[model samples]
Target: MEQLLYITIGGSTHTATMVSNAATEALLTRLKSSPVTVTLNSSGGFEIWGALGFSLPATDEPVNAQPGDIVLYNGSNICMFYGTNSWSYTRLGKIDGLSESELRTFLKAGESNVKVTLSLSNTAGLQSVDGSVAKSNGSAYTLSGTSACAGQKGVCIKNKKKIIR
Candidate 1:
């Protein structure tokens, strides 16, 4: 595919954790109840690609279900071979970072169906009982929508529990 289908975080820093958690919840809500999965990959690092995928709801239902898109985080195996560790190697580049213009575009496009998922190497982004970005809105800030999440409409799957904030 031309895009990456996964979201991966490399560090346990505060900013990284917040973004990682928010991104994952935002993406999962966009998935529209699709089956979720995770895997481990050992990349060599010749390439790194990021993409946002979308799928519309099969039926028109008001349940906060809309056509949304997902922002995928990716890295190449080639980078893993470099001196850098997995965290630095997998962290997205300028093109995939929050500052990229595509961030908004991806969210807007995926507002209907794409559920965002994030894979973190550390616990930086874990949320409390209340839905809030643990860290300040640094490079990114997400707009709220129709999902169970109040600030945002997507559901968050953390610690293996499905919670919609």
Candidate 2:
């Protein structure tokens, strides 16, 4: 099943969905525990990090990504963008109904760092993952120790692929 992820940053909440795959499965499973909070900052045209220490499928990498695209970067980072990027990114979902300028305003809420809360939403859609079908739900988690990763640009892997959150 395709599920929605609610990202609350500052005063705005954006919704996104995941592409069906084992990687996405692993991520959804972690989400059931609680919503994951990650410290994020603006970089280039996107807000990167809030690394949930969650891993997912590095499946499809779109040649280019537009605003409101939620993507898995480097297999560990969940990146939401307000601008365009070209890379092999496993697309999680896109934020619906936000105009381009509105998205930029949301992402650029601040220049330093901002905290984002991610939780599974009530809406769902039909999708496939590893040839299996099951219903899944989620909310948020802790971001108590990832302040160190907040100021940096791009996803930084620690201890050989660990996000160190």
Candidate 3:
């Protein structure tokens, strides 16, 4: 629920300036400050996005991700970087409770519902998982993924409480 902005990237373009730019853009947006030299702590790897692969916009008129290159969100961890778009929300921490099976089912269901909510609703802005989850305390649990949500590592949660009821 606490929405924090962090940079995320893959191994494919570590050396590429574009990768740096993407990170820069994310940081700038998240940090909302003038650009400056920044040091990043990262675990290296390569991943691609989109059906074709690449997530970078084409330099030419064709604005789409190229094949083999994965699309990246500005603030997510890698892997399921973008549940739908190049951006997603993420949170991380030591899970305090909930059995493994319960956690699994919660995440699976939450991910599915989140995707549907995202697609159907105009949720273009970043939302506080911690804030929302906090409100639903005891109703939800976290599912952690090594991958990025826009490029940051953290926990994903499955809320057990039924809001619909």
Per lDDT, the best of the predicted structures is: 2
Instruction: Give stretches of model 2 more than 4 Å off.
Output: 60-62, 122-165
Model 3 per-residue lDDT tens digits across residues 1-165: 222222212110011122334443443353344212222221122222112122322222222322122223323322221122222312111112334443233223223212211111112222444544434344332221121234222333334322221
Ten-residue stretch with the least lDDT total in model 2: 133-142
Relative to the unseen true structure, what is the C-alpha lDDT of residue 107 in candidate 3, on a scale of 0 to 100? Answer: 25
Candidate 2 per-residue lDDT, tens place, 12-45, comes to 4556766677666777778787777777777764
lDDT comparison, 2 vs 3, better candidate? 2
Clashes of 2: 9
Candidate 3: residue 29 lDDT (0-100): 53
Q: What value of lDDT does candidate 1 attain over all alpha carbons?
A: 0.28
Residue-level lDDT for 63 in candidate 2:
48
Higher-lDDT candidate of 1 and 3: 1
Best-to-worst order by lDDT is 2, 1, 3
Worst 10 residues of 3 by lDDT: 8-17
